[model samples]
Target: MKKDIILAGVGGQGILSIAAIIGQAALNQNLHIKQAEVHGMSQRGGDVQSNLRICSEPIHSDLISLGRADAIISLEPMEALRYIPYLSPEGWIVVNSVPYINIPNYPEIERLDAEFAKMPHVISFDVDAIAREHGGVRTVNMVLLGAASLILDIEDTKLEEAIGDIFGRKGDKVVEMNVNAFRAGREAGKKQMKG
Candidate 1:
């Protein structure tokens, strides 16, 4: 199994956390993983993107070539669109519908929606709202990760285990909250996939 994922979001949205969880999960499964990250002005809510590649065999490159990504998992709508050229023909785009408007002139939500509508495989939803419902806004990244999990080669239990391990230092409560948020996102993603 192999998965080339592009993770995109604005700074401070937990994009690195998402990468960490996925990396841990892949390790647990004994898979080879390569990652490349670009923290573009992240301190000021600028775009932060990561290229995550996982497979059963050795990986030589950290970067994913254009139109080769198996999935684009984004925490922001606009950021999701920014990496479209990197997505494969059958690539899935699992992204949050909420916008983190850090720029002076962000595109309208309607326009973004229309653009996403043109895509063949897109799972877009208000992950922030879902996070609020499950564990609060802070779990937004986990929520988006949960949605992306459906398309990932890793198992759900593995991801949950990674979550537990990662957040265990913080306490059981934090881990449970994140796990819940992940599960909620997975369920939402399932619904989106169905309809």
Candidate 2:
């Protein structure tokens, strides 16, 4: 099995954390993994993206060429669109519908929605709101990861275990909150797939 995923979001949206969790889960399953990241002006709310590749066989490169990504897991809608050129024809995009609105010239929501609607394999939703309902805004990344998990070819229990391992240092409460957010996102993803 092989999965090439592009994770996009602004810095501080926990893009790295999502990468970490998925990376850990891949390792837990004895999969080969390669990752590359770009933290453009992250401190200034700039774009942050990561290329994560997982496979049963060995990987030779950290980068994923254009039109080869199996999935794009984004914490922001605009960021999700920004990486469309990198997604494969049959790839899935699991993204949060909320806009970060960091730029003055950000595109209109209607236009963005229309573009997303044209896609055949897209799971777009208000992950921020879901995170809030489960935990808080901090868990937004986990929520997105949860949605993406359905197509990630990794077991959900492994992802949940990785979450626990990552947040274990912070204590049980933090871990529980994140796990709850992940489950909520997973349920939402199921509904999105059905409808």
Candidate 3:
């Protein structure tokens, strides 16, 4: 099956990190994956999006054509909505239900889910709160990743192991904190799925 996923959010929100972690984890599974990111004005805190295509065969360029995305995982509501046109029919969307937090002078983005809720294929969650409670709010990205895992059909603990392998050597504390964050986010998503 073609697994085309987009991880989107404003800059510095760990959108790419989440994609990288997932990509690494999937590599362990021997999947053929191609990924890229649109780092538009990333340094200025503008929108950043990563596109990942995982399949049994080699993929093409970073871009996935319109209406072909199997799943979209967004770190913010507005970012999720921004990519609505790319989702395939009956596609799954995992969005962080947290309100957008941005610096002044940025465009006053509206809620993405407000529109998504009217769609047939969509799921939203308040992963930011869940991440905040476990590993400080900075870990919201992990929470978003975990939330996105629902549609990807990947085990959360595997993701944790990937995070550990990637970030563990930095320091014991950092690794532990991220592990906690990943677990907390996974649990949050699991709870949402159960509900």
Q: Model 3 over residues 126-194: C-alpha lDDT tens digits?
A: 887787787787778777776676778677777878888778778888778877877776667766652
Off by over 4 Å in 1: 40-42
Q: What residue pairs are clashing in model 2?
A: none
**All candidates: CA RMSD (Å):** 1.4, 1.4, 2.7
Model 2, global lDDT: 0.90
CA lDDT of each prediction against the hidden true structure = 0.90, 0.90, 0.77
Estimate, for each residue in 31-135, the C-alpha lDDT of model 2 and write its tens digit. Answer: 999999875566468888999999999999899999999999998899999999999989999999999997899999999999888887988888988998987
Pairs clashing within candidate 1: none
**Cα TM-score per model:** 0.96, 0.96, 0.86
Lowest summed lDDT window (length 10), candidate 3: 105-114
Candidate 2 lDDT for residue 168 = 98
